[model samples]
Target: MVEIIDVDAENVDKYGFFCMRSKPNSDGYQKKLNWVKERLKEGLKIKIIQENGRQKGFIEYIPGEFTWRAINAKEYMVIHCFWIVGKGQGRGFGSQLLNGCIDEAKQLGLSGVALVTSEQGWLPNKKFFERKGFKMVDKIDEFELMALSFNENSKPQFYDWNESAKEYKEGITVFKSDQCPYIQDAVRNIIEASKDLSISVQIVDMDSYDVAQKKSPTPFGVFTVIYNGEIITYHPETKNRFIKMINKKNLLTNS
Candidate 1:
């Protein structure tokens, strides 16, 4: 039996978000819980999919005007996360969740439902959105902005991230938000890795949607690592991975 439940601020504690379900006490989970609470007021929605009384997956989205991604999608609904894992795969649960979100967007008179997809890991892949009739409207690096528009001419596009990158031309800078449950660990590892290399690092928190839309160097928006003015990674990496990445770029000299 497949069932979908709507999670709101009032019941989010009772029905935890899909990620970190086993580690609710972790900093990442608690931070995400608080973040979700604030985003709920901005028209964010989370729906969980269950199969035979077990949680299988969840989908999270918000009105585009309030989105944390680097996009100008004021009249659209932007999906932040979508996952169907374990036994939920190949069972049409993903489509079910997407269709529900689409229906809600249509009901709200939004232009479309937008999503950021990638060929890399973390975000969903573009093929899934393509199968559901979404089209790529913009591309930056490995990330693609896709949308299924109700009005043919209306589409979402990414911001001019080049200008944003120019602002962090020196040293290692990490931009992060609480939108993802795993970013806390990633940021912590980044700090530790930089310390080991005897490098100075700056941490910028995307405390508001305005800051995120204007300054996030990539569509992922939640976590980004910039080394010497260029975006290195859009998602989190382990301490060792960070060390190797910096070394590979020759950003630091081996004394």
Candidate 2:
């Protein structure tokens, strides 16, 4: 059974499913746990599934401040991030988590919920949002935009994100590759951590790095935060430091 718990970031040292693979005391592993805990404080809403009283799987949802036009800003829940761990697989646990999200949204009086997912091959589509009754409302390049509007009237109205809103002063641009799940998870965590910040996230496919660099001159790294089109941080695969980078970036831009 999946039970929603009000967990503090500190308890993950023992209860965090994310750190089970490696000894938590190891320096690098401890860093990862700290990162998860920090991000959790930034709008991270978590739920865990227990099988025979052991955590078989868990999901995390980060709610952010950005408003989606789903049934107006008055009634919409934007799912900034959600994840189900590897141990939590093959038991229909994912679907249960999704249902829980729906029920939670309904309880909150949200007209609907909106999220972004890969179009099949980009990520495991089946495990993403397919069975949750989410439908493709639009597609931009390889990324697919989806929504599950509880109230039919709550459909999302989107427009071309203002690519020209304002040029970032200057920073590093870290191009993220899909091959690294840890990097992806880091990105997810930071995005969640950035819930109330005045920042923008652009998902780029590293496959087009050379082309993107030629298209625009900037430092290219993976799973990183950018400030004015410059790379602020780069890691081969680590979830920590992203939020700190993002917080710093936002300050620079908003200043």
Candidate 3:
């Protein structure tokens, strides 16, 4: 039987939300756990799918105002992460988890459910959300802001990137947070890459939703790598890829 477990302070320690079954004792896990703990009081909801005592998938969402993204989340629930791994993919688990969020939004009398999606990296592709009746509300760069609205008058919006991106003027600047378990490793990789390339990279650790919403270089929020005032990407990659991206950018800049 498939069971959905809501992660709370009571059972958070018992289950891994993102980096499931691996790196339990790692700093990333602890950081993300602590982040989750704090957000719970602000209305973050995380639901995990389990079958035969094994975790199969999970989804995390929060009130728009408290969402890490730069959006004006006044009357909606913004999904931070949604995933169903391994054998969980082709089954009905994804729908189950998504429907759970939709149902909760209705209960809370939220205007709708919203999320930022992309064709690449951390966020999910737009297809699934579109299939579930989410419409493309806005777009910033490659990220698509999608929402499923119950109220015809409610229109969700993406945070202002034009002003936010201007916050970092030059060099390699990384705006990051502990919201995801893997971000620690991603930051480490970026640091290592910076050192190898002899580049000075500034790390801006986003400790709260306010900081992220106000300072994120990209509208998608989470983790972003900015090179010379322009956002390279919103997701982290390997050291080699980072180097290549930087080198390519340098080439274009010098050309």
lDDT of 1 by residue, 1-255 (tens): 889989998899989888998999999999999999998999999999998879988899999999988889998999989999977799999999999999999999999999898877599887888999999998877878999999988888998886577678787999999999899999999999999998889999998998898888787788889988877887788999999998887745445
Tens-digit lDDT track of model 3 for 76-100:
9999889888988879999999998
The residue-level lDDT of candidate 1 at 72 comes to 90
lDDT of the candidates, in the order given: 0.90, 0.50, 0.86
Candidate 1 weakest ten by summed lDDT:
246-255
Model with the higher lDDT, candidate 1 or 2: 1
Tell me the lDDT of candidate 1: 0.90
**What TM-score do all the candidates reach, one by one?**
0.96, 0.52, 0.95
Off by over 4 Å in 2: 1-6, 17-43, 52-54, 64-75, 80-88, 119-128, 157-172, 175-181, 184-255
What's model 3's TM-score?
Answer: 0.95
lDDT of 2 by residue, 1-255 (tens): 456444566555556543244454554455446545655654455566666666655555444232211111235555534456577677777677667777777787777766645533223253366666778766544445567877886565334432421354433344454322355565565555545454455555544323322222221112434556554544442334655666666687789
CA RMSD per model (angstroms)? 1.8, 12.0, 1.4
Worst 10 residues of 3 by lDDT: 158-167
Better of 2 and 3 by TM-score: 3
How many steric overlaps does candidate 1 have?
Answer: 0
